[model samples]
Target: MTEAVQIRPEQFPLTRECPFSPPKEYRDLREEAPIARVNLLDGKWAWALTRHEDVRTMLSDPRFSADRSNPDFPQMVMGRVQDDDAEKSLISMDAPEHGPARRAVLGEFTVRRMEALRPRIQEIVDERIDAMLAGPRPVDLVRELSLPVPSLVICELLGVPYSDHEFFQAHTATMVSRQSSVPDRRAAFQAVQTYLGDLILLKEKDPSEDDLLGRQIIKGREEGTYRHRALVAMAFLLLLAGHETTANMISLSTVALLENPDQLALVKADPARTLPAVEELLRYFTIVDTVTARVATEDVPLGGVTIRAGEGVLGLGFAANRDPEAFADPDDLDIERGARHHVAFGFGPHQCLGQNLARMELQIVIDTLFRRIPDLALAEPVGKLAFKDEAAIYGMYSLPVTW
Candidate 1:
């Protein structure tokens, strides 16, 4: 057999020369070796799928398991292995278990349910903007606007007390941060888990039908389906994902819109275009790039390569979003692109559970922010901004802005 070409693995995350664009090397990977092997932070090798179709296919295939507890599963970041007894959130499970777990609380995030939340989401956006307007010049939008809006919304939805927002938000930040040591991440995980576990017990004892967790608790009891551990696991996943992803997107999207004047003008001119604009923003700024890594349970044909059983695959969603085959001028921030098909939310059955709610929240926040502050602009040069370069989830750490 002809010796397979040997290409030294480029480090995972392939550092970005520009914050708004993927690393320039991705273009080469897509054209030359779409299924190239890459070295992760831990100096481990895994197949990194860069093409859109390949990523979607891998995500949809049942053979590629999402169970992180699998020792062979790829670890993109250098950290401790996941706890075996840890709550098996939907993001970390495969079929059969994943489907039922997802369906239980799926009703809470449907398009209809999210649509019902539009008015409240708008109110939350407006209220935050009100505070921003009242504050002094050159406010940090991340603190005043981006962080609180979605945090408050998810808190209200899950019936977690909004007053305790700071508690969970701090722990979540540690959990997602790349700079956090393994012990720090573990501590953060346990802290939130303990908090949610206690909250679930409370909800079970005294259920509130209106809240998402309360409803789940009541339903679990009525159906005798979910045990205490399952309910706690569900709450942990929702609370962490609920706020962090959307909050980062809010901060990052604001920066994207401000930087692209022409594109920003389009959304400002037509209010109806905001929905598509939100989708395009999600595509362009795929913040959660590291979320989708899976281990193959069986030998799988993927990206013209046979991923043997027990091998790991990292579906680079950020890279896929920028694939030329999937998008024309993929790097451009075209608010009109309507790139809803992008895998920014991951593809297949394990796609983001709260995407519908995320869409509504982003639409309302983006539209209302610009409408209320028509002159909104970055307070400093974009080059001077401090991005979350050390974080697994990409976003600006602090977006300073003025109107």
Candidate 2:
């Protein structure tokens, strides 16, 4: 195998100078050093994968473990948040444990289940749009529509009351931000964990058929898979990821489409085109690119290098999605390009379970927003907009827009 470049971990998870694309270093790494040792935010040295083929290979390969408790597992976030509990979140689990954990909630996110909720999702998106149209001009979509849509959906899904959205949303934001102090992130992380843990306890005692978590509680109990701590971890994952990632995608996608009128026209003119457009945008942003990290269980040869046992690896989703080898003119946003292999939702056993829900939400939001507000335009210049550049997930902090 070829030698991989060695660099300090602090030099990794490079900042995005352009809100629309991955960090400039991603290009350099993909072309010159597809697999390189780089220091992470926590100063841990790990091999970072930049190529589409290699990222897919590494993520799918069982040799690279996803157990975050493993000292060798990479810390991909701005601040490392640890739970003292022995139960690991599904995203951080490997093999036998991961499979059962994921399968427990898999039915909740299947295509049929997600599709059944489409009409409800449609109502939510349209209602948010209606509120936006009636409310004051120059609204922040992040607050008004983008954030609320997914936040509401997930709130109802997990049986959490929507009135307490601010509490969880605020804490969720703190946890993902690079700017958030370690103590602050810890506090936010704890606040949400405590809240969810309590909620899960209540749900377990009185299961309700009306919600996903409630239903899961009943289901898991029958299967002998419902451990309180483990359920808490799953609930936390679903609650946070359910809203945050999809919120960012909605805002960023609106910006991308607004900026590219020609491309926007394609989506607007054809209702059938919205699905591919949503997929393309998801691929284009690959917002959660930094988090798909793993550590080698044993030395595994991949992408012209051998990632040693106990070494960390990151599949640069943004870089992999934008890989020229994976698409023609990979950097350019082409909604027409049917790129099904995009790692936006990632690959392998650990792929995002809420992806079906997220996709439907995006499809409905994108299709409805533009159709309702034909004159939608940016109220502020793209360059002046503040982006969540320091966050583990890249997104616009606020998208100023008017119809």
Candidate 3:
């Protein structure tokens, strides 16, 4: 039997040192050896699950656990910066713990809830559009729309004051950025924790009748199943995950659409085309490259390779979404790919709880942007557009555009 190829941990730090997109070497490795050992930041090794089927199987397998409390678990970017207890939110929980915590906020992200927010999202979209049009000929969409829309929506949902957005947004960017220093990353995590801690207290004293934070506080307290730290952590996860990923998706999708005028025109000609187009774009972009880190609970053979107990597994979502085996002509942007299955929002027990809300925001933004500014075009060269290179969430710093 051929010995398994080992990828040294020092070679791949989660920082800007790693390529934003999977490099040619990764593609080659995926094909040659689906399960390869790769070095992580701290000189520790991790099993990189590269193939589409292998990633899907690993994500769904009970042996792969998301719990970060395990002492042997490799420290991913955020885990390295924050305390273990603090990282115990939904993304880090396994099975039974992950389920109820996720369930606590699932209803608020349902299609029904998102559908009700459609008109409000539309209004937000129009307001942003109007502001953009009223600006100089060219404006940065990342600044004007992509970032603000979701931030504002999530703010309202969590009942967080918009005044505090700058502080949180800065922290959010630092926490997600690959180039951020260890001190900056730790500070960012603490900033978010402090902000959420205060918000929880505020909610307890004067609850908003219907917001998600308020609702969670009520449910948590009523069930007598809540801890102060847990409530803060959960709220932090919701606010950050709720907007940050969707914001990146919106920016990335807009960039993709603008790059493909034919598809953009197709969606522009008929607003109804936005939904399907968004799905295809989500699959094509697959902006969230990796899911939360998972650890091997026991010895598990994945894709003919044996993973020993207590190894870390990183699910390369970007690779899986673009796998030719799963997606036909995966490189081509087909706006109308019927019933596409992409792991953009992740999969299984840990799938994104706010997916419906994300889709609703994307749909409304896309439909309204094209309708309001039919002549929108990229203000800068596509290649010149600066992207957040080192972040777990792939996004642009500024998406300049003009109508």
Candidate 4:
């Protein structure tokens, strides 16, 4: 039986009253109205799925389409940083197309492959920390460590020159930020797309099988599946997503552990717990919450509500991860929770492809930073610090630390 929903739609992209946790409204809605309606920034309405079970079920069901180009698909933010306007890649592709595209690239991120990159990742973390140590007492970890680690990794993986990171990262900032005008977003998207398109041509003239995009170009043409436009869009997705999401997680995870000293002590005392703690951090701070909004292809019954065909549903992953039914003491940040089942990476067909790599990067960064700088402490209170509150992604602008 479908439960009754509320008549008044809550505003989408709800603000966090506290930086450490999700909005309190989510907790109430999870219990009372798991499928509550939300008014988006574009003034469009979509049902926000708060319950963990419902979110997982909806994401997996074929009846709900993941295609961003679908006219009825929910646009949670009015002008999103990244564009899904081009040919379908893994992100916006559904079913048959999604399967092939995912398979083509999945090998690059396999556990064995990621494990091979462990030494390199550790080196990156150590170098960043070394620089931080040698420099002034107080440094912005966002610049010193958080952003650079993932940004450099993605650049290397995609064959992009790390020298041009400033240009792309600046544009990425404008793109993800909701404060940017639609025209600003379009320009930013074009800048990235144009840069990637040119890179695609360069790879065609002189390609290397070492990097991800180049490998795809070489392999796809041989298989007769190569499309220039599709490949360019794929690069854009990989380049932006590869860096942005993980960078935010790195910063947020550090702050989380610092705030909860007991959890930090547990992790520092035992080396084996780092990976599980990273999983719990992923669950605790599900940053890209509503970006997975989907439109129903057919009338579907969910959480005691009939979502009619053409209607949209916002998968509130942040809320679902904190659902009490799926997690014990949902609000508490328990690093020992062993929350491997959490939907921080989303679930089923659309789970994050780079998850294994992300896990490895976070583990190396967190473990090394603490071990090297045993006296590491925040230079400023979290309240006084600037946060990316207006951005599509949830993270801080800077983390000032002194050791």
RMSD of each: 1.8, 1.4, 2.2, 1.7
Q: Provide the TM-score for each candidate, comma-separated.
A: 0.96, 0.97, 0.94, 0.96
Q: Could you tell me the lDDT of residue 23 within candidate 2?
A: 78
**Positional deviation of residue 162's Cα in model 1 after best superposition, in angstroms:** 1.3
Per-residue lDDT of candidate 4, residues 286-376 (tens digit): 9888867899999998878899999999899999999888999977889899899999999989989899999999999989999999778
Regions of model 3 farther than 4 Å from truth:
1-3, 8-21
Using TM-score as the measure, name the better of candidate 1 and candidate 2: 2
**Clash number for each model:** 0, 5, 5, 3
Scored by CA lDDT, what does every candidate get? 0.85, 0.87, 0.78, 0.87
Candidates 1 and 2: which is better by lDDT? 2
Q: RMSD (Cα, Å) of candidate 4?
A: 1.7
Which ten contiguous residues of candidate 1 have the minimum total lDDT?
Answer: 1-10
What is the C-alpha RMSD, rounded to one decimal, of candidate 1? Answer: 1.8
TM-score of 1: 0.96
Q: At residue 319, what lDDT does model 2 achieve?
A: 92
